[model samples]
Target: MSFNVALSGLNAAQKDLDVTSNNIANVNTTGFKESRAEFVDVYAASLLSSSKTKVGDGVLTAEVAQQFSQGSIKFTNNSLDLAITGNGFFATVPELNSLETSYTRAGQFKLNQDNFIVNSQGGHLLGFPVNADGTSASVSLSTAEPIRIPTASGAPQKSSEVDIRMNLPAGDSFISSAPGNFDPEDPLTFNHSTSVTIFDSLGDSHIMTYYFIKDDPSVNPNEWMLFASVDGKPIDLEDPAGGGTNPVGGNISGPLSTGGGLTGARLVFDSSGDFQSQIPTAANGGIITSDFSNHLPNGADTSQTIQIDFNLDPLGPNPNEPTQFASNFEVTSLQQDGLAVGRLTGIDIGTDGLVRATYSNGTSEPLSRIAMVNFANEQGLKQVGNTAWKESITSGEALAGEGGSGTFGTINSSALEQSNVNLTSELIDLISAQRNFQANSRALEVDNQLNQTILQIR
Candidate 1:
């Protein structure tokens, strides 16, 4: 009995040493959790034995339980590296379409050949589908899929509208040439000129120049004539107030004949330099509409029409309209509603695990939301290799949710979670286990000497 007790003590002390050594060895490992060895005294007695005289047996190894505490975060330069500040695990699968899942805290992730995010072991990281506004469609683990980034260029959009605000010089001289003669090549034909780049349906850019010709003040006071040309070809502006019909408080002659004719839109201002009205009004809120189909580049959309908005708002108290001020000509604002084909620039991941992709066209699109999972019993998880775990009977079912929601933690991009093991505590435990082993060895030696003495007495 004494020999059996001494042997049990030796085994318990060895188990303690093994557990402490493992904690110390993995102190620097990423996402590693430390474990502790537990023991209980082994004692057995029959009902006839007196309780007061009973002596306890040696210690027995119970279990080596893992401690799933929070690990420190270490930042890195890679944007794909992730770390959880609180509770949650990143769910992954061995294959792209595999449903068999494993949970891990190790966030060393990179893009594979197919642009799918994967870890060092080639496990595909799972993410939930997201809407266009960056909201998750579903948070269930079953609906999660492997995230893939598209390498294609962003879609192109044709120019539909243009908002321009400018101050025309009130003291500028009229055109030296004929009243309706506006030439893009000759500076004397127009008072001032400004050019803007506009996009076609095929993502091609073209220069659209606006020529401002101060009309003969003797004929039309406080009035200016605006002519537009695309690629140096004249484009005709549609008469919004119907053909041959002039607007109120405006001096506009009958519509000019089409087919290579030099026509212009009339801009009328009040005495105080405030924009009162414009010719070709009554349509599109007094803005001029021009169809560039006749002068568009080959293979471009011929039906695309651009509306030039002078920011005229009669309802608002302080409308952002173009002004004919005494100051020099200055354009306060100019913007076009068009986009060219965009190439992939970079990627960003937010705290809520939302992944967004940026493009060269100044546009960003939401790709996916990372899937996070938590178990009811983290300690009961069966440890797999590579600091990963599998669900077992002791561990409850995995509860899936988005990061920074519910009991889950926020995700930190470009960071990693270091091991939670404490080296100083592990070293102290190593010394204690060594002493326990030595004491058990001394007990065994004493037991052997007692046996030798008994044999000598015989």
Candidate 2:
């Protein structure tokens, strides 16, 4: 009986040592939770025996319980590395086709060869699908999928419309009215010039230059002649070369007579510097139309018409409307509706767990949202190695939710959760376990000596 009690004590001490050693060993492991050894005293008893002086047999190992307390967060350089600030675990999958889901606190993630975010063990980080508005498609854990980042955003889009808002110097010198018309080759003909890059159907870029020439002040004080060109080629206006719709037969002079030369509209400003009226051979609400289909490059669509809008409504936003200020000609704002194939530039995670991807085209798109899961009893989860756990009967079904919602924790991107193990406490526990083991061994030695003495007496 004594030997059995001593042996049990020895086993309990060894179990305590094992638990403490494990805690110390994983002190630096990311998201590692420390465990504790629980024990209870064993006593000999009968079915209905009432004994006030009952003696205990020995210590028995009850359970090895894990401590799931929050660990300190450390920020890292990688944006994919994540850390949970409160409660909940990151849901993951071991493979693409795996049906079972694993929960983990470790968030040391990186992009795999295929650009899927995964852990070092190749386990994919699961996330909920997101809509275009950055909302999660579903909150169920079963619906979570591996996160994959798209390298490129579809195809290129051709420029169809352009919006321009600028100030034309109202005090510039006037040019010769009749003989000195707007010319792209002669700088003296135009007072100010600005250019904007426009894309074609094939993503080829072409510079569209706008030239403004102040008219003779004596004849038209509030009038300014405009000239449009593309890559130095004149853009033909709907109005003929002469004043109105009539096409003057005589050949024009200077650059206006060139092959690509095109007549432009005239801008008139009120005395208060506000826009008054603009006259062109053909225009719709102050918007000039150009057919780039004739100048399409590299098999691009030649029938594409580009709308140039000088939305200079006096009632429009002050910054978006053109002003005839006595200042240098400046383009306040120039916007276009075309972009080339976009390359992935950066990725970010929001407090709501929405993963956003930014492209070189100055656009952002929602990729996927990180999925968080909570259990009724975290201690009931069965450890599956690699700082992860598997669902068990004791652990109730995983409650799936987005980060920062309900009892779930907010995800800190570009960070990692350190191990919960306390090295100082583990070292103290180690020493205590060693003393307990020594005491148990001393008891066993005494029992052996007593047996030897009894045999000698016999």
Candidate with best lDDT: 1
Q: What is the TM-score of each candidate against the true structure?
A: 0.92, 0.90
Please state the error at residue 114 of candidate 1 in Å.
Answer: 0.6
Model 1 scores worst on lDDT over the 10 consecutive residues at: 251-260
CA shift of 101, model 2, Å = 1.3
- Candidate 2 worst ten-residue window by lDDT: 244-253
Error of 2 at 445 (Å): 1.8
Following a full C-alpha superposition, what root-mean-square deviation does model 2 have from the true structure?
Answer: 3.5
Per-structure clash totals for the candidates = 0, 2
Candidate 2 versus the native: TM-score? 0.90
